[model samples]
Target: MERDKLVYKLKEFQALEAYQVDLFQSQIKSLEDPHIKHAFERFTVREQEHEVFIKDQLYSFNGGTGIVGPAFKFAGMVTGKALDLLSLKDRLKLGIAVEQKAVQMYHEFIEMTRHDPQLKELNKYLSYFMIDEELHQFWFKEHLARIENIEAQPH
Candidate 1:
């Protein structure tokens, strides 16, 4: 029963991630700037991949919808659109914050599954993904700075 609960939680997280990915993709679709659109598209794809990975792991346990996916979709739409207008530095800062939250969630899930062997293994993969996301945030920030420097040139 407890394992079932954990599976449900994982499924809920996956669904939320999926909803956000959809929302991000939609927001990116409206952007005119290629570079910004590309960044958003990349984020959307990465979120979608993470969602699928989580879903596959949780599906074996027959987990059902744990949270309201529609609500997540709506919230993500609003947030993603607002973020799309921010400067690259702000976007990267926001990404870092989001990744930190994800890392915390993964850590909490890891602790919650202390008794579940399979979930513990999944948690290790999730931790690696969280690290990857953190690296992405750093790279975005660095790239933003480089862009700013180039734009500062006299023309």
Candidate 2:
């Protein structure tokens, strides 16, 4: 793809991701557990920071006025509300899946963009997010396993 087209695509992606920022904050409200609430709070902050960085990257194009991204069909905030209703086991399962999805998205971006010299810096930025997502997934999964083990007990 041409440089302009690639840049445009990235801008759109950034915008879509930016739209998801509020969902993270909403999630923190849904979590009752102090540790989980705190974790989501951190995720919320990072997401907001990520939005700013993406906006800055798009600043030169369209005067930083265009967050023209593809539409996200599902209501993510509604998902957070639903998560609040689920049991801890269910929430952990879904949270881990969410992190895994983020990791997958970064890998896909890296795979598609790494070959382009222009995208090298974006790939580097995405790699950092991927690592964080992986770590979050690990943290959640470990807790989930402990919960499962306790439930599996003969008590």
Candidate 3:
């Protein structure tokens, strides 16, 4: 791809990530468990920070002005509220699936953008994000296991 095209694609990707961060933040409010709510809040903040860094990279590459981070974050808050109705087990299962998708998407983004100098730093960031998503999957699995154990015991 031409450098200009690549830059545009990177900016688009950043905007998409911002949207996702917002979605996750919105989901946080629906969580009944304090621990889960806290975790989601922190995770949302981290994602927002990641979006900002990506926006900065895009700007540095070509003086691009993307969507505001807060706007995307508010969308996330709405999503969280909508998802709040799910049970804990159901929510964790959903979260695990979401993280898996994120990991795959990040990998694909890295592969697709490997040739762009404007995207090199973003690639590294995605690599770290892949690790974080994997960790989230693991945590969700652990929570699932604990829930299973609790359900197994006789009253």
Highest lDDT scorer: 3
Model 1: colliding residue pairs: none
TM-score, cand. 3: 0.74
Span of 10 residues, lowest total lDDT, candidate 2: 71-80
Candidate 1 segments exceeding 4 Å error: 30-36, 63-85, 147-155
For candidate 1, the per-residue lDDT at 136 reads 61
lDDT of each: 0.66, 0.68, 0.69
Q: Per-residue alpha-carbon lDDT of model 1 for 39-104, expressed as tens digits?
A: 778878888888888877766666444542222222233364576677655655665566556666
**Which model is ahead, 1 or 3, in terms of TM-score?**
3
Cα lDDT tens digits, model 3, 1-155, are: 46565566556557656765776677776667798788878777877777787677768766665433332122222243556676788777877776676677677877877886766777788788778778877888898889999999998
Kindly list the per-residue Cα lDDT of model 2 for residues 1-155, writing each as its tens digit.
46455556567556545644655566676667898788778876776766676666567544755445453343343454565577777767866776676677668877877887766787788788778778878988998999999999999
User: Model 2: residues >4 Å from true position, as ranges?
Assistant: 1-8, 15-20, 65-69, 73-80
Ranking by TM-score: 2, 3, 1
Candidate 3 residue spans exceeding 4 A from truth: 65-81, 115-119
- So what's the TM-score on candidate 1? 0.66
lDDT of 3 at 26: 74
User: Could you tell me which residue pairs clash in candidate 2?
Assistant: none
